[model samples]
Target: MTGNHWGYGKDDGPTIWHKNFPVAEGTRQSPIDIDPHQASHDPNLGPIVLNYDHCTSINISNNGHSVVVEFDDSDDRSVIQGGPLDNPYRLKQFHFHWGGKGCHGSEHTVEGQSYASELHLVHWNAVKYKSFGEAASSPDGLAVLGIFLDTGDDHRWLHMITDALYMVKFKSSVTDFKRFNPKCLLPSSLHYWTYPGSLTTPPLHESVTWIVLKEPITVSEKQLGKFRMLLFTGEEEDQRMRMENNFRPPQPLKGRKVRSSN
Candidate 1:
């Protein structure tokens, strides 16, 4: 979870992922260009929680375009207890979104505006886990927690894993990370915008209850620069072939209503 060894470097890079995973056909992805004028009403949302706490198996990887700190060190899954998810779910993965500079990478638009990056805390309802592969094909199988990011502080929260950057890369590895509580990164206020949507990645399975936190967290420009130093592996050849932009575009609010727990 902490070491920053993973990324699109020279060796284990995106080109291979493209070959193996190629974008799933008809998958709803992220990073779409939105026009602010398209803002819509946010309805009333249900409950949410962060379940299965105590321990986690963390992973740091270069997901093509940006570096992500994925939660769940192993099969031991941690808990996040509640928000707008309606039911209890298991914390699975946490990843991030970034841009060449600032001004992009978030899935939802704010009154039509986008931000530099976004962090997603992905979760899955335990009831559906016995067969998540199958359940994921539907709308209620997954739950994703979103947090917006902007420029400012150095984001000491990231220090939670910053020192680990020296560990795994090109050849992804896992480690025993300490008390890195995801909740610590959350703003004191829990105000959020909720909606029914699909995973913002391939397989774009429409199995999600998305909770977008209202307050955005800040990370310094220097901290962000560290991401660029990541290498899928070693060398220019491998670096040129890393995974980037694994995000799915937003689906039509398709007459679908968005609920908020403000």
Candidate 2:
């Protein structure tokens, strides 16, 4: 379960993750199915605000699990506040979880319905926590904005990321991806469903305050196909595994009330 041994394969997938990361079965685990009807509407919940105009995107890389775009979080240049957050959380990185050809792969679902993919923009509590690693372990230390991706017409700004996917196709590969602001990837509406949940991947720490957008961004099948081309294995590895279906299924809600922004 250590050092890239865990994967989407039958033997090493989410079903077996609990053997290593015991918290995988924790009460507040994430990627839960969001039942809109059951979610309580909070009248006092303010609209979530994102200030990413000055975000310094550093690089894009393949980390054997998913493709991640890392940002320079040394300062509070870019952060997310309002909504359920008490303070502005510093933006750390963004990544995607997707399925194979012609399959739905989103982590969190709406009323049991699945989307083609999910995008996670991760942030940390810089005011209270000294480092991202420290923030990731404490409850209420992280905030992750989840956006669903539906297949249809092409997404105008998504091409900026997809165009560079070829450069980091293999695991551990990284390339310079500067000056690319993720604000362009957002939908017009900021309406979201908020909850207290954990990370969807390994070390599934229950620290994140999840804000999942109600609106889904559209991208063409051709664009999604580009992500499928990425390999989970490194270039030197003889057995090349296609990086697809890289999503953990929805976890139990555990009686936690999901709140919706008005």
Candidate 3:
């Protein structure tokens, strides 16, 4: 009903991204399929071993279709070994990529296929943004650490995310459970897909330096339904099914490159 927290199938479908938020067009996006022809063999990048400690209570917000997480003070120590030592990027926000009950939801398909959902650990170059949105225009402003999702039996895996789904449904709604860390959500292996791409959502800002994990974490069907519950109610009056297909349409390949850590 309001300007924010749009699930899927509404007037502002994921495809009409650029039209909804004029500023979104200015920010880098994700969930793009990689073109093998353009995918380069960059020596500087490989599987990034992330060493994050502060979780800051994995808070989520429904920015129309997908949810975005805001990390309190998360950083990246997984930069390419010989690359920049002090990672100027600070974990700013995060979100997910999901499919229906029984399918893939990954953004970058492996040889043309999607996963059930992908978890994006979005960060901003502190060297750029005094505030999160400040660096929306800078090409090197964002660094997104992506992890894949699969079905699993451990309920602990959903602890940080599923618990806080209700608070951030709409704009200006904040949820803080307690002090937490980000390292717990990750697995032992850090293999991933790296690339330079635009935002998967509208406005399509091309400022993100992405690192997508090769391995995926699994969740039970009941778990994903909880995420759907995040947007079940709208504006205190419009209580429609708010979680219908909140995925963004794939973007034009437009001459970019993708890298991998496998």
Candidate 4:
């Protein structure tokens, strides 16, 4: 798994990830199935607040794993607070996971039902840690907001990112993508399910305080197809691999209690 050798293929997929990153089988691994009926509703939980009014988005890139839109988190310009968080977490980057044609590919499922795609807004606890890398390894150092994307009418704001997919179709490609605010990607309701979990990808660090929104945002198949056009292979590679079904299946709950926002 060193030097980005891992992928969603038969030989090197999620199942075999633990061989390299043993934390993959950790107790708090993410992308767990969220059972609404089993989740306890917490009236004490406050509304999740996102302050992206002055957010500075720098660029977008294909990092071999997913298309990531990075931000300049040097200051507290854009951050998420309230809800299950004790302090405002600085927005670092956001990426997505999706399925192939006519397939559901969300990471975290609802009552075992999967969505077409899932969006992750990664934030670091700048108040406690000095850097994003430090925050990622420590427990309670990160907060990832998960938003499910269902198939339907086109999302007007999503085109901003999808339109740029062609520029970074190959892995390790990057291009200028400034002033794009992710606030537009949020659903109508901030009501969500909260739990302690790890990253869905490798190095499955169990440091994230997960906040998954209840309502799903709708995006047309046409828009989602734009994501599929992206290639997991680099431009130099002879083998062409379409980036689809990049999501990890739901992991075992392992007695973890999911809490619902009031």
**Prediction 4 TM-score vs. true:** 0.97
Best by lDDT: 2
How displaced is residue 106 in candidate 4, in Å?
Answer: 0.6
Give the per-residue lDDT of model 2 (tens digit) for 1-262. 1443688889999999999889999999989999999999999999999999995999999999999999999999999999999999999999999999999999999999999999999999999999999999999899999999999999999999999999999999999999999999999899999999999988889999999999999999999999999999886534448899999999999889999998
Error of 2 at 164 (Å): 0.4
Model 2 ranges off by over 4 Å: 1-4, 236-240
- Alpha-carbon local distance difference test for all models: 0.57, 0.94, 0.60, 0.93
Better of 3 and 4 by TM-score: 4
lDDT of 2 at 157: 95
Better of 1 and 2 by lDDT: 2
Worst 10 residues of 3 by lDDT: 77-86
TM-score of each: 0.73, 0.97, 0.77, 0.97
126-155: candidate 1 lDDT, tens digit per residue: 665554555566667777788887778888
Q: For residues 1-262, could you state the per-residue lDDT of candidate 3 as single tens digits? A: 2345333465656655556665444423466775555566666664454545444544556655566665665334322221221355666666786765565556666556666677777667666467656655567767777776677675575766676776666534666645555566776677666766655654456777777666767677777766666553346535465453556645545455666554
Tell me the tens digit of each residue's lDDT in model 4 across 1-262.
2454688888889989889888898899999999999999999999999999985999999987789999999999999999999999999999999999999889999999999999999999999999998999999999999999999999999999999999999988999999999999999999999999998988788999999999999999999999988999886534348898898888888889899998
Give the lDDT of residue 230 in candidate 2: 93
